[model samples]
Target: MMVCIRRLFLLLGMIATPAIASPTISVLTDSLEHPWGLAFLPEGDVLVTERPGRLQRIELATGRQTIIPGTPTVSASGQGGLLDIALHPNFADNRWVYLTWAGHCETGTATHLGRGRLVGNALEDFETLFVATPCVDSGRHFGSRIVFDTNGYLFMTTGDRGERDRAQDLTDHNGAVLRLNDNGSIPSDNPFVDDPRGADAIYSYGHRNPQGVAIYPDTGALWIHEHGPRGGDEINLPVPGGNFGWPKVTYGREYWGPQIGEESIPGMVDPIYQWTPSIAPSGMAFYRGDLFVGALVQTHLAHLELNGETVTQETQLLSELNRRIRAIAQGPDNLLYLLTDQRNGELLRLSP
Candidate 1:
């Protein structure tokens, strides 16, 4: 009888496999041209950013797209384009919005964080809030992901601009997590405020190219996942004033042949999770919902979860969705939404 029950279970597994909609995909908006970032407003409208520096609004119910005017021009070169979009904490009352993009600098080009008032249907009072110091001409490695902490401080990640040594430079803002007040002022409580070696805005350093950043709703801890050189993607929990050893102490190599650095570093913080042979992780989010009971607790995200780390007995989704996922966020309906990266990208919705 036990053998017969086991055989019945096996048959049920096979029958239920193909029809299960894991990482369930649904099109929120179709015919969108290179949508990079998405932020839902209080009234259920979503503001999406196009890579070529255009902002648009999509009504959730109607699926209508309207282009927002008065957006700033961006450099739009190799990996340098309109990036993350975030709404101000008090957006409903304040009508403010923030954006990050690669902008033109006097020397060359650099990533800039700008804020403005989102009037009834247009963006007004555009202001360049923060410009990365010592702008370089290289258009690559513009890590412009943005997130707001519990204290209403803005955190932005900047890449090393294809220069590995810049990750270790204290004076340089590249390859560092920068903390700023809402209006782009350095907080007096920031770590390294008086350190002559490092900039005051530098909260933590030694990152390759962090794209995904989200605050843990339960613990208020800041979590990030960055792309590795050739392999060795990392999920890190950043502490205040901590030094995350990048090229100096990486699980990855130089993409040519040499090792990155020694494994034993005294003061450097090691990643809690590391993936070898690379998942090309771009965006991350912590799942907190009741849709998948007995699963989905502090689940770190990636496009694929072949060798993922999780605290619950969750199943791997998106096994066949062969695409580089760029962003993930929770929607108003308690469902998960994701954006795929490609020439013809897609906005996907997921459920249990």
Candidate 2:
């Protein structure tokens, strides 16, 4: 029965809708102090983080806010700030919450991962679990997003720190998807563990600045959306030992001028989807709900449909939202929720 329902959705997604509905945007909370990340608790409370290093809990019904203490200090520079927050897979029992942020080192800023227990409105026994080593001096590229796999491993995305060449460097953890045990230890089965040139912590390599990652509930596949140089934004299925050709091979052009890398390189992986003109895509989620039949069918992709030129009935929700869409999640009631990025960003709910 489940397989039949999934197949039906796939068929409907290829068709077009007659009308596009405008989302009803509401200001859930303002003056949030540069909100960066959001996650929902099982009891219906929302946890949000401020880029300047503060965590707050928002009551879903009352709209009341409480600051969560014990958060670590963040660099909070250009593009470098308190980044992503994720609840542990078993948050109900463990109360564990994970955080990814830009931490300052003697040389510069690097993305770091930390975990703590959320007790009431405070964080208890907070500890730094993993820190990106050989930190660079620039704050340009801190690709710090967190997602947990069904196998009980925590995966994180890291940028190349604006050093284009590092994307192909197996010796560094930058521009790669890192797989680690929940407690911050390297997994023994990681793909590059024994490779002399590769870092054991790496799961995949050759990425630019990946900002969004989510696991497809139905397929358990890891999906990622990354920023391209001038125009080529990409959606890819991240697999261990796969090389998602970035600076070495891209469908995008250099920011300064004409095309840069070749799109056809030996052994380079191709993106499942690419967007020209750059949506600057971030924080993706696979919607598995009854409200949007079309979206549910396209479970593995970021957007509901392909490019505008290909589908006239499609609505460009990302462009209409204006601000960079930071995070996406499905609520308890099976409604789609989105987090916008900006000083006065909003939390939007999408339903039928």
Candidate 3:
């Protein structure tokens, strides 16, 4: 394993006082090689995916980690490698685990989804489910995040490989949100299932390196957020068969600060929230626990504060952490867990 040095330390971004109390942050563990995603098992252990290509379980009680044997030989260069991890909706009974990663494609690498059964400390019956089409040599943009909606369908994001033109081409699988069955079959009701104009598995299109995907369990509303070029980081509510207008109608500009395209077009959907100067948003989760009260108590979308498809109030929660947050997951206990993107990624616990 290649080791990179990064230290995880405490940060109090907001000062605490008698009238206003800020959430406390604690370092749970460290020494993770750019940990990319996180999942909690039925037994209460937390699963982590290191971008360097390792899957490990961390004991919540002790922070002790056990490397789970049997991960695919992932392409671990650039922004590729092991990405997102999710358990079957019925994980307790079936023990099925799903993973999204970068794999060897026709010439270079492509985003792939696979599933295996976790038995003891190893994965068994591993199989590839889906591979994003058009293998590109670039290692920059593989937007691989997996989520299961209430109806038990899988949705995964695919980036455009930094190729701007392909995002506008429906025939290409790049830059789209795809809907598939648990077994990797295209969902019959997917927007493009019968349309010869686009990939049958695609649900929506024109995305730019989306890194976060989550479904509101109660509402079953799907939400996604992605990175913009320089400015224009955005959170979006994706609709079936809808066009998001990446290179054509983005609020972002080119790397050197030249405008990319118009800010709005007729058919392209607009983002609910846009961040200029790019905070580099990665992973996000809607709060689903009893730990939060007052401003969050039974409120609708308090953290990101989303009302339907729009964000009302947003707060900066981790400015003091001084690290790029790669993923966020709300544990069963309502405590929010954060994975920092670093050579030595740290597991952080945020509590009110």
Candidate 4:
């Protein structure tokens, strides 16, 4: 009982102290062009993907950017291009670098997952692993975030490609979170495995442009956030076979001010947190190394205090930057790194 009371008081304290101290922000480099995703190499180097079909390796000590060769030819249309990047859990031994990109498909474009070995400055033996199916020609809503959980299982997200009804379908990969083995094979224990009604790789469905996903500290729960039309940006903790309602149930409206759907549904999973005016959330990471459950918000860094899986308090930081913070990750040195979205994007480091 004492432990429960103490936790309650702690959460109250966090909510009461909303003005958390801001971190010291410094510009590491301003030379990046629309940097989308980043992964920290074991040797302290950073691999960043630019949306325009380019992969860059940045030497942190000297801020030198080198264009890594052997990237696939990307569609590079609207929201299509090189997207997310992640290293294999055993990358030190396997030297494997996995990436997600908008690739040309018969219909138009689809998000493709591929990997290659990093030998010297180029990706060698690059091969496409898995491709999202039923590609559509639309330029909007390609979610595409890659993450590996503690068990070494790979999780990737895909949007509905601007087709809202596709999110409710289980036969296609649209608007779904997929799980696979490190070798790109479907896991037999997947929620929809052997179920003819759904795709085998889909773990969760009915998301709208989810761009950020991270595993919760200690619990190993995978958390995700997605973009809503004019409002209703959401953060969700997805379970296997979960259905997160998008257009059929949302807190958002059309861009011209019309309701999309009902605010809630009987079977749909709702968000743990949501942004009504739409902060336009992009990338996210838990303060994992520091043992904090917080993550960066859209324009500001948000410190989330959680009691178990529930977010009890949220403190926003770094609002003064006034920049569209795209991706954020905690570095090896325990500092936070942020990528600003722009034609002339920047890499910023934050020291707490």
Top model by TM-score, which number? 4
**TM-score for predicted model 3 compared with the true structure:** 0.89
Q: By lDDT, is 1 or 2 better?
A: 2
Ranking by lDDT: 4, 3, 2, 1
* Candidate 4 residue-wise lDDT, 1-352, digit = tens: 0011123223223334546533346677888888999999999999999999999999888789999999899988898899999999999999999999999889888989999999878999999999989888888888889999999999999999999999999998989999999888999999999789999999999898899988877788898888888889888888899989887989999999989998889999999888788777888877732212222335665567666767777766556666677788888887678888778888877543
Candidate 4 overall lDDT versus native? 0.83
Decoy 4 TM-score against native: 0.90
TM-score of candidate 2 relative to the true fold: 0.86
Q: lDDT tens digits, residues 268-341, model 1?
A: 98887666766666666665421111001122233222123343333334434455567777788766677766
TM-score of each model, paired residue for residue: 0.86, 0.86, 0.89, 0.90
What ordering of candidates by TM-score runs from best to worst? 4, 3, 1, 2
Query: Candidate 1: where are CA atoms >4 Å away?
Result: 1-23, 289-316
In TM-score terms, candidate 1 sits at 0.86
Best by lDDT, which number? 4
Report the poorest 10 consecutive residues by lDDT, candidate 2.
290-299
- Minimal lDDT window, size 10, model 4: 1-10
Residue 35 deviation, candidate 1, in Å? 2.2
Stretches > 4 Å off in candidate 4: 1-23, 288-298
